[model samples]
Target: MKKLTIGVVGAGIYGNYHIHTYCCDKNVERVVFCDLNEERRIATADKYQITGYKTVKEMIAQEQLDAISIATPDPYHFEPAKDAMEAGIKYLFIEKPLATSVKECEELIALAEKHGVKISVDFHKRWDPAYNAIRDEIKKDEDTFIRGYMALDDIIDVPRKWFTWTDKSSPAWFLGVHCYDLIRYITGSEVEKVYAVGNKEVLKKEGYQTYDNIQAILTMKDGSNWTVENNWILPVTFPKSNDGQLVVVTEKKYFKNESYRGVKSFTDKKESIPNYIFMNFTQDSASGFGLEPMQEFVADILSERPFRTSIYDGLQATRIAQAVHDSCESGKVVYL
Candidate 1:
C-alpha cells in the first residue's frame, strides 16, 4: 500500500476518533492533529503519537497531507474544508451540519468540484449495519412508512458545552439531523415538507431558547411520511428498565434498537400489542463510533470508489433539519 499523508482538525471528543482511526491506518502517514486548545491538542497528539498543530493553516502549509478529517464543531466545517481544498488535499471527511447555510454548502461543493477533492461528511448512521439492513428490507417497497425517535433528556456534561443545552436549537439540529439523514438513507427520499411542534416545557428554566422535546413530521418525496419524536430533556435521574430507545417501524417489518438496549424485528400482523418485541439488541451488534467507518472510507478512496456518506447527503440532512426549525416557528407545513 502506498503511504498517504493524513491530518485531522480539532481534538474534541469526536475528533479523537479521527486521530485514533488515522493512526491505525496502514496507508496514512504523518497524521497532523489540529486544535485551538494547545493543551488538548498536545495531550491528544501525545496519546496518539502524532504531530500536533495549533492551527489548520499551519498544518496545510507544512504537511504534505493527502486527506484530512474535519471534526470540529458544527459551525466550523467550511474553514477547514475550504482551506484543505485550497491546499489541494485529496479528500475531506467533515463532521455533520456540513455548513451552517445552503449557500455555504453550495460554495463548498463548488470549491470541491473546482479542486477535484472528494468531500465526505461524518454521517455515521450510513455505516450502521442495522440501518443497512433496514435499507435492504425496504428497497423494493413502493408504499412505506418509516417512523423513528431519538430521545435523551437534557444532558449535562463535565464542562457544560454548546451541544447539549436548551437554545432555540433543540437537540433537533444536533441529534435529530442524524435520524433525518438515516430516514433519507433508508427511504431513498428527500423531505418534501416539514412541520414540527416542540416545547421546552419540562426543562423549564426562566429564559431558554432551545426546546428539550420536539415532535416533527417529515413528508417525503414519494408521498410517504416519517415522524420523529426527539426528546433531549427526559431527566437522567429517572431510572427506568431501559436507558434509551429507538424503534424504526415500517409497514411490513420493523427494527427496534436501543443503547444498553434491545433489538427486535417483527412482521406486523395487526395485533393490538406493541409491534416489536424486546430481544438482544446487544452492545456488540451496535456499531457507530469511528474506526470501522474511517477504515471503510480509506478503503473506498484507495479503490477509487465514492464514499456512502458524501457532502450532498449532509446538505440534504441540513435542508431537512433547517426545515424542521422553520416548521417549529411557522406553525405550518413548510415545503422543502
Candidate 2:
C-alpha cells in the first residue's frame, strides 16, 4: 500500500473541491495547492490545513507531488497542466474543456504522452446515473440514436459574480463542453460537424464579452444529431445555481433526465432545489457523481487503472467546442 502527495492549481471554488477531495482520499498522504489570489490561497490552505503556494512552479519545486489536479479558470488550464507535465509529474486531473483552444488541448495531450503522464478530464456528467442509465439502455440493443437535446444553464449571478473571467468564457466553454463530452460518452461516437448560433446581447449589455447563450447542432459519426443549448442568464430567482435537462431519442427508445431530481427546499428568503446527486460534502467524506471523477483519478493512479475520461476525450471535446465557436462566428457549418 502506498500514498501520494498531490498538488492542486487554482484554489477557487472548484479548486477547493479538488483540494478537499484529495485531502480526504485515503491513498493520498498530503495535498498542497497554489492560487494567485493571496486571500484565496490563505483561506483555502487554512480551511484544508495544507500548505498553499502562489504559483504552480513554486508548488512543484517545493512538494514531491505524485500528481497535480488543475482547477484554473476555463481558459487558463494550459499553463499549469503544462508546468506539471514539464516538471515530470506523472498524473493529472483537470477540470473540463481541458483548454479553451483545440491547439492548446492537443499540445497538452502531446506533452502528457511525451512525459508519460496520465491525464483525466473532469467531465462529470459521464458519471451521472441518469446519463449512465441512458447509455446502458441504448447498449442493451442496437437502437440507432436519432436525436438528443441537452440544455445546461446557470443563473445570472454565475457569470456576473461567480468568477472574474466571464468575458473570456461563454456558455459553450463553461457548460456546453460537458454536454458535448457526455454526448460522445453515451453514443461512443465523435462529432463530425457543428453548426451553431449564439447571442451575446445579455452579457454584452452587462459589459461581458461573451455569449449569453449558444445553441449547437452536432452531427455525430454515428449519424445521430444532437442539439446542445447552453446559457448562464437564467433569472437569479431560479431555485438552483443552474438548471439542465437531457432528452435522447432513438429509433425505439426515449430517455429524459432533469437536473432537479425530486428535491426542493423552502426558506423565507429563497426557494432551492438541492442537487444532492451532483455534490455533497460531509464532515469526513465527499460523495456524488460530480466528485466521483476526482476520487477515481486518485484510485486509478494508485491502482494503475485507466482513467474513465482520457486526455483524448478532453481533446475531442475541445475540438467540438472550438468548432462550435467557429461556426457561431462564421454563421456556417464547421467540419471537424
Candidate 3:
C-alpha cells in the first residue's frame, strides 16, 4: 500500500497533536506544518523534524499532500478547509464546531460534496468509550432525558495571555459546541429549539469582550429535553483545565460520567486531573479518544470506507450552536 502525505494548518495546542500523530503513523509518507506565526511554525517543525510553511497555500503549492488537517481557531476554519477541499485533498479533518456560522457550515458541506472529498469533524467526544457506552444504552430506549455540562475552562491566562481572539469567540463556541455535538451523538437527535442566557461580568471585568458563561436549554426532535451549561471562568486553582459531568437518564437506567475526574493526582501546590482518555501520549503512539476519530478518517480514506462522523454531523452541531448564540442575544427561545 502507498503511504499518504499529510499537511497540518495551525500549530497550537490541538494542532500539535495532529502533527504528532501524523508524524508517528506508519501509513503516512510525509507530514508538513503551516502556521501564520513564524515562531510557532518553525518551532513545531523543528520539534517534529518536518518541513514547515507560513501558509496553507505555500504548503499545498510545494508538497503533494494527500490529506490535510485544519486545526486553526474556530472562526478561521472555513478558509483553510475550503482551500483543502478545492485543492482535491482526499481527506480533510477539521476541529469542531466546523465553522463559526451556519452559512459557512452549509458552504463546507456543499464544497465537500462538490469536490468529492471526505470531511471529518474532530468531535472527539464521540470516540470516548464511556460516551459510546452511554450512547449504546440510550439507543436501546426510544426516549431519554440527557443533561450534560462540559465546563472545559482555562485560567484567565488563556484569554488574557495565550491568545487575544477571545472577543471573536465565546464559551458557547469554544466549549458548548463539544457538549452539543456529544449530546446529539449520544441521543441521535437533532436540536429543535434553544433557549439560552449568558453572563459577561467575569471575563468582561477582566477586560475580555466576551461572555464568561452560557446556559442553554435544548429541546430535541425526539421530544427529549437537555440542559447544557458552559463556562470558562474556572479558577486557576481548579484541579483540571476541563471539569464537568454528563448524565443520560432513561426509564430503565442512568449513566453518569465524571470525565474530568477519570484520573486524579495531587501535588505539593496544586491538584490535577490528567486526561489520559483524550490524548494519551504515554502509550506507544498517541492512542486515545481524541486521536481515534482523526486516525479513523485517514484509515477510511485509505480503505474507501464510510466516515463515522459525516460533514452533516459537523453542520448540525454548528447549527445548534448558532441557535444557542442567537437565543442568548435575543433573550428568547430560537426555533430551528
Best by TM-score: 2
Per-residue lDDT value at 332 in model 2: 98
> Candidate 2: which stretches are off by over 4 Å?
none
TM-score of each: 0.82, 0.99, 0.95
lDDT of 2 at 10: 95
Return whichever of 1 and 3 wins on lDDT: 3
How high is the lDDT of residue 299 in model 2? Answer: 91
Off by over 4 Å in 3: 141-155, 282-284
For model 2, what is the alpha-carbon lDDT of residue 150? 97
Clashes of 3: 0
Q: How good is model 3 by TM-score? A: 0.95
**Candidate that beats the other on lDDT, 1 or 2, i.e. the better one:** 2
The alpha-carbon lDDT assigned to residue 60 of candidate 3 equals: 93
**lDDT per residue, candidate 2, 53-94, as tens digits?**
999999999989899999999989999999999999999999
Question: Candidate 1 residues 1-336, lDDT tens each?
Answer: 777677889888778767766666676666787899888987997887778898898988888877888888776788889888988887888888787677778899899889998878877766666656667766757446656554433343211343432353456666777778887887777889989988765455645556666788887886667777766654333333223445666667676765432433344542122212222123223123435567777778888899878889878888887788788887989898
Pick the lDDT winner: 2
Candidate 1 is scored at a TM of 0.82
Q: Kindly provide the TM-score of model 2 when superposed on the true structure, using C-alpha atoms.
A: 0.99
